[model samples]
Target chain A: MYNKIGPIFKKEFSSYFNSSIAYVFIVLFIFIPNLMFFYFFGGIFKEEMATMRRFFQMMPYVFIIFIPGLTMGSWAKEKNEGTIEMLFTFPISQWKVIAGKFFAAWALVGIAVGSTLFIPILTQLTMGDFDWGQIFTQYVGAMLMAATYIAITFFMSSLTMELIDSFLLSSSILLLLTLCGYITSAYVMIFPDWLGWLKVILNEISLSTHFNNFSKGVIHTKDVVYYLGLAMLFFYFNMKSLESRKWS
Target chain B: MISVKNLVKSYGHGKPAVKGVTFTIGKGEIVGLLGPNGAGKSTIMKIITGFLNPSEGEVLVDGLNTIDNPIEIKSKIGYLPEKSPMYQDMIVYEYLKFISEIRGISNEKADDAIQSMIKLVALEKVASKRISELSNGYKKRVGLASAMIHDPEILILDEPTAGLDPNQIIMFRKILRKLSEKKTIILSTHVLSEIEAMCEKVIIINNGEKVADNSIQELMKTYDKEQFIDFVVEGESLLSIEDEISQIKGAWKIEFEKKEGKNQFRFKALISEGSDFEKNLKSNSNNWKLVSSEIKKANLEEIFLKLTSQGEDNV
Candidate 1:
């Protein structure tokens, strides 16, 4: 199984490194978030700074767009060119193929996330005081968020052969997850106590609520479970989508 | 060896793409799967390769069921699909190397196999070129090299020469023939001439069912024992001449077509055993002039059309 998966990882990684698309995505993911933080929230560098709160605040929005763009073509291109049929004819299992592609895309996002560490390092150099625990916690939160988004986008890519369709479907799902908190809060404010069950379910499904806890340097087991559960859910669906093509 | 029993595959609950298709290819035989377009040749190939599961029935390769032991079966087979599916962004050497590693080949052997396959397929000239830059023929050669890189015992090729020039077609056929010496080959093509040139046995499918499966010689024998003779004659209203020829003692069936101008007609007559066709044409008293006459042998094309087309007389 490792032998079968190793080649897929190497091929995908080489594709990401050789193409300019990876560079473009890395630049946008790192520079845009920092640029936004510096331009809008200049108080992050103030003498009475408490934590890297502003940086983590900007990650959800940054990842909402960046993750979809990075993963929109993970499996769509293979299906479009009929290479998936050739790959399936090999001795490798379907689960290994899916796991290999998912891990490769996650690793690419990990590189992009790693590049942003320079910003925090710069702040620690220029400023005497910085919250190390908060910064570490926020990095963990960003990794989890990106992993979940990558899984969702990879699943959407497997569901369609058209790249544009994959992009649209991924972005729409990300947008919904990002806005779930606001939608749930509004429902609680307008509805009466009789229909309060709707608000309870909405809050449980909201990813932002769990991300907020992690962003604030709080390592709750429930939050970890939430992100891991979502990731597994999407990955399972991705495998199922691939298997369904054989019968259809 | 490969064996398929009552293989049935359907798409979206509609009519079956391959219905009750059953055939077997021995370890050293090179069999050709001949069929027209949409005749379920690819579907059968897909099932045998373990790329698609059959809706009903079983496929056994080398004594292992395709569904129960797909990975083991897949490792024993190499396949080249109809479209020549390839990663266009990969260089020729890189793509073959990736396939080698994926198939669990060690580094030293992978290197040696890649070298041999590149030489075998004559891809040494453009080994470093990306697949997109190569011509269609070169891309197809790369696909073939990838399929053979692992040294599998069986090869399934679908329309392997679909997009090649006449010279490339000849070269491709030569490559397949050479490869068949060491591997069982199941070559599928709609071109009847290629089947005639390469395959010892031919299996034809029509409307998703096996219509005929036999050697080329056996298929020819099923039509009729009467031999057909084509002659060029100078005459009008050859119908009367055909009627007259049909009335002869040994002439079974006679037909004629006018060859435009010069008052020439192309005539064909089926003659029974011990009948001298040349002698009978010469002994005729009519004003018909016999230019030339020869025994016509039925090629695969005629047999293919006769088996596939509806409402056509058997002879």
Candidate 2:
């Protein structure tokens, strides 16, 4: 299985380098939020503490767009180009192909997230008070969050034939997952005590709500399981979408 | 090497794309699947290649069931789908190299296989060029090379020459003929001449069902028992030819199909059972001139048209 999957993984991974899209995505992913955090009014770097709180705070929103852009064409492009049938008929199983493509995309995301390391490194050098443990957990949470987003986008990509449709659908779902908790929390504060239970449920379901635990250096078992569980759910759905495509 | 038993396939809950089609292709046989568009030719090929599962029945490749051992079956077969599925971003060499590796060719052997395939498909000139930069014919050659790179025992090609120039078609046919020596090849096309040029046995499908499956000579001989005569008479119309022609002893059926000219009528009818109505027609003509008389044996093209059209009329 590794013999077959290795080539698929290598091919898909290198395909990102064949064009400027991957580079452009990595550059944008690293710079855009940093630009917002360092240069925007009321930025985080203005403080002397060098905490990554504000950077981690903005990640959920940044990943809503970043992960979808990276994964929108994972399967949609294959279907659009009519290569999916060729890939499916190969000696390898569908799960292997799906896993290979997923890992390839995630590796690019890992690189993008890894590129931001200079930010924390520079913070430690200049301020000498960077929270090492919090920063490590934050990066872990970011990678997991990226995985969850990639899984959802990959699933969405398998469901549609158009790249734009996959991009829109996956980004929309990511947006809801990240922002709905905050929206419901604010509404719960405004409403009476009777609807406080609704807020609890929404917060429980919200991805950002659990992601915030890791961002704060709290390695809660439930939060880790929640993100990983959601990722697997979406991954399974992606496989199902591909399997159903044969009938379609 | 491939056997499909009562294969039936449907998309979702829609009408069956392939319905109760059964045929077996032996090793080293170059079989042509001739069909009209939407005739389930691609569906059958996909099922045999283990890309798509049949709704009912089963397909076996070299005695292994497609569903039970898809990877095993797939490993033994090289499939070229209807659309030449290619990665436009990758160079021709890179694409074939990827296929070779995925097919489990070792690193050392993969290079040799890729080199031979590139040479075999005449892709050496454009080896380094991206597939997007190549023309349609070259892309098809790339697809063909990818399919053959694995060097499997079976090859299932779905309309492999759908979009090739005359020269490219000739080159592809030569390649297929060379590859058929040890490989079981099932080629699908609507072009009767392609079947005639490449295939030893032909399987004709119409509207998702098998219409005819036999060797080319046997198919021709089966329908060759009856002959068609194109007889035209000038100077008067044979308005009552159906009535008068039937009395010519062995005349099977007569119908004046078209008006050839102002005073001429052309009739096409089957002459079966040792019918010799031509002499009777000439002897009975009052004023009309027997301008031309010709016998027409049903060729493969006519048979394909007849079977497919018959399929449509039934629907």
Candidate 3:
């Protein structure tokens, strides 16, 4: 099993570097976020807050779009090019291929996230006192959130043969999930006397609500489980999509 | 080396793509799977290669069932799909090396295997070029090289010569003939001459049913019983030739086509077993100008047409 997964992972991971798009994506992901943190209209300098709280707050929304673009061609390209037939006929299980692809995409996200270490270092250079613990917890949360988004994109990629469709589907799904938390928050403020328990359920399903826990420097066990569980759910669905081709 | 037993495959609610079709191919045999469009030739090859599952029944490669031991079965088979799909961005050598690694060739041997495959498939000229940069024939050679990189026991090629020039097709046939010396090959082609050139045995399927399966010679001999003689004659009225030929016993049918001159004609006579048409034609040489004559041997195309037409008539 290691023999099979190793080669698949190696090939998949290297394929990202074979094309110029991956480098362009990584550059944009790092460049845009850092540029926004430093020089947006009424940006970090105007906020007067030395912490990266605003950076963490807006990242989940940024990831909703970025992750889909990063993963749109994962399975969709393979299906469109008809290489999925070649992949399935190889001497490896379907799940291994999915796992290998997941790790390759996740590793790219890891590199993108890792490149943002400069932001924290710059924050430390300017501000004498910064909370390292909070930043560490926030990075952990951001990586977990990215995993969930990548998994959703992987699942979406498997559902169709076109890259644009996969991108649209995943972007819409992430948008709807993000909107759930905002809608439920507004609902609670307007009708406090009615259906208080419903707000709790909405927050339970909303990714932003869970990510908010990590940004606040409170590492809740339930929030950790929620992010991991969502990632697993999409991973399971992606495997199912790969397996369904035999019947389809 | 391969066995397909009562294979029945259907796409959702549609009719079965392959309906209870069964055949066994032995080692070192180049067998051609002949069929019209949508005749389940690709479907059967996919099932045998473990790319698609059969709705009912099973395929076995070297006694391992495809349903149960798919990866094991896949490891022994090399398949070039109908489209010859590939990663267009990858260089020819890199793509072959990738496939070699997937087949679990060790680091030391992978390079050797890939190099030999490039040489065998005649891909050295474009080895460093990206797959998208090559023409259709070169891309097909790359696909074939990748399929055989692992040195699989069985090679299943679906329309290996779909799009190629005449010279390329001839070169492909030569490669297939050489490959078949050591490997069992199952090829599907619409070009009947390709089958006649490369295949010793054939399994013809139509409408998801096995219409004919036998040695090429045996199938031709069985389905092509009538002997046809083409003769050129002058001073024979083309209109009265059929009447004159029908008068001879065992002369089943005759057709006449006008030649260049006014009185010259070309006649094809279908004769039965008891007909001594050669002697009779010479004896009646005075009646017409017997310019040149030769017996027409039945080919695979005629047998395929006869079997498929008979199948249509029955249906």
Candidate 4:
């Protein structure tokens, strides 16, 4: 399994660099947030900031576009080119291919996320008194959040034949999943009394509600499990989609 | 080495693509799957390669069921899909290496296998180029190389020469002929001449049914009972010659074509069973110049249409 997954991961990982999109995605991911933090939220990064809190705080939301953009073609493009047939016919299992692509997309997203480490590194030098632990936890939270989005969209890529459709569907679903958490987390109850149970369930299931723990420098086992569990479940869905052709 | 038993597949709507088709292929035999477009040739090949499962039947490769032992069967068979879609972003060498790795070739042997495949497919010149940059013919060669990189005992190619030019098709056939010496090959094509050129056995499918499966020579003789009195004649107007040829008993015209602005005409007539049409044609009219005349058996093309068209008499 490792032998098969290892080569697929390597090929898939490099496939990102094979096109200009990886560079484009990395540039945009690093710039938009940092650009906004310094330009729009300048006050937050000033003396009020002991950690790079504002920058990492909004990453999960920003990933709604970038993550889907990278993964919309993971399976969709293969289907368009008819390469998926050859890929699936190999002596490997479907799970390994999905896992390989998962890690590849996850690793590419990691690089996009990792490239922004210069932000915290340079900011820590200038501030001279920064909570490195908070920054680390924030990075971890952002990555975990990105992993969930990648898995979900990777599965979305397999559901559709067109790249545009995959991107639209993935972003819409990610937007909904991420937004439900934000809406449910407010202190005042936003829904009617009868619908209060829905808000509770949405909060429990919302991605940001779970991500809120890590962004706040708290690495709870529950939040970690939530992100990891959601990622695996979606990965399984992607495998199921690949195997659907065989389903009578 | 491969057996398909009562294969049936449906896309979950309308009619089943393949219906109860059964055939077995021997080891090292080059079999051509002959069918028109949308005739379920690719569907059956997919089931045998383990890319898709049969809805009602089972495919066995060397006694191992495709559903139960897919990986083992897939490893034994090398498949090239229709139109040869590839990862255009990858270089030819990188693509082959990746396929070799997926084929479970060890790191130590992978390089040698890649080199040999490049040489075999004549892809050395464009080995470093991206697949998208290559022409259709070269891209097909790359697809063939990637399929055969592992050197499996069985090779399944779906319309391998679908888009190639005449020169490339000839070259591709040469490579396939070489491979057939040691491997069992099942290649599907609508072009009947390709089967005549490369395969010893032909399996013809029509409308989700196996119409005929036989040796090329057997298919020609068994299904093609219509005998043709093929002849070429030269005459002016030929109005007199036509009326005379039409008067002959036990003979009906099958095809006729007159060369443009010329006195030459080529025609074939299907003679009735055991009739003396050849002698009657000689006695009927001697006005036209008889450039050539011969009574011949129907070729593979005529036999294929007769079998696949289901007695519609496409001729």
Task: State the C-alpha lDDT per candidate.
Answer: 0.83, 0.85, 0.84, 0.86
Model 2 per-residue lDDT at B131: 93
**DockQ numbers for every candidate?**
0.63, 0.71, 0.59, 0.65
Q: Give the Cα-based TM-score of candidate 3 against the true structure.
A: 0.87
Which one is best on lDDT? 4
Candidate 4 lDDT tens digits, A1-248: 78999988999889989999899999998889988878887735574676676777687789989999999999999988888888888999989888888889889888888898887778777766778888789889988888899999999999988999999999999989988888876644568789888888888888888887787788999999999999989988988888896764
Q: Model 2 compared with the native: what TM-score?
A: 0.90
Total clashing residue pairs per candidate?
Answer: 0, 0, 0, 0
Model 3: per-residue lDDT, tens digit, A1-248? 77888777877888888887679778988988877777774455677766777788778888988889989989999999999989999999888898888888888888988888888788779864778899899999999898898888999999989999999999999988887787887666754757777777777888788898788777999989988999999999999888778876
Query: Higher DockQ: candidate 1 or 4?
Result: 4
Q: How well is candidate 1 docked (DockQ)?
A: 0.63
Q: If you assessed candidate 3 against the hidden native complex, which CAPRI class would it receive?
A: medium
Model 4 steric clash pairs: none
What TM-score would chain B of candidate 4 score versus the native chain B? 0.82
TM-score of candidate 4 relative to the true fold = 0.90
Native contacts conserved, per model: 0.78, 0.88, 0.77, 0.81
Q: Which of candidates 2 and 3 is the stronger one according to TM-score?
A: 2
**Docking band of candidate 4:** medium
* Per-residue accuracy of model 1 over B72-137 as CA lDDT, tens digit each: 998898999999989888888999999998888999899999999999889989999999899989
For model 4 the local lDDT of residue A74 reads 91
| Candidate 2 structure quality by residue, lDDT tens digits, A1-248 | 78877888899999999988799999998889889888883565476567887788788889888888888899999999999888988989888898899889889989998998998898788777778899999989988888888889999999888989999999999898888777885665565689778777888888788887887877888888888999999899988988887666
Candidate 2 lDDT over residue span B196-261, tens digit each = 999999999988999999999999888776566778877643655445554554345555778876
Worst 10 residues of 1 chain B by lDDT: B306-315
Interface RMSD of each: 0.9, 1.1, 1.0, 1.1
Candidate 4's displacement at residue B246, Å, is: 17
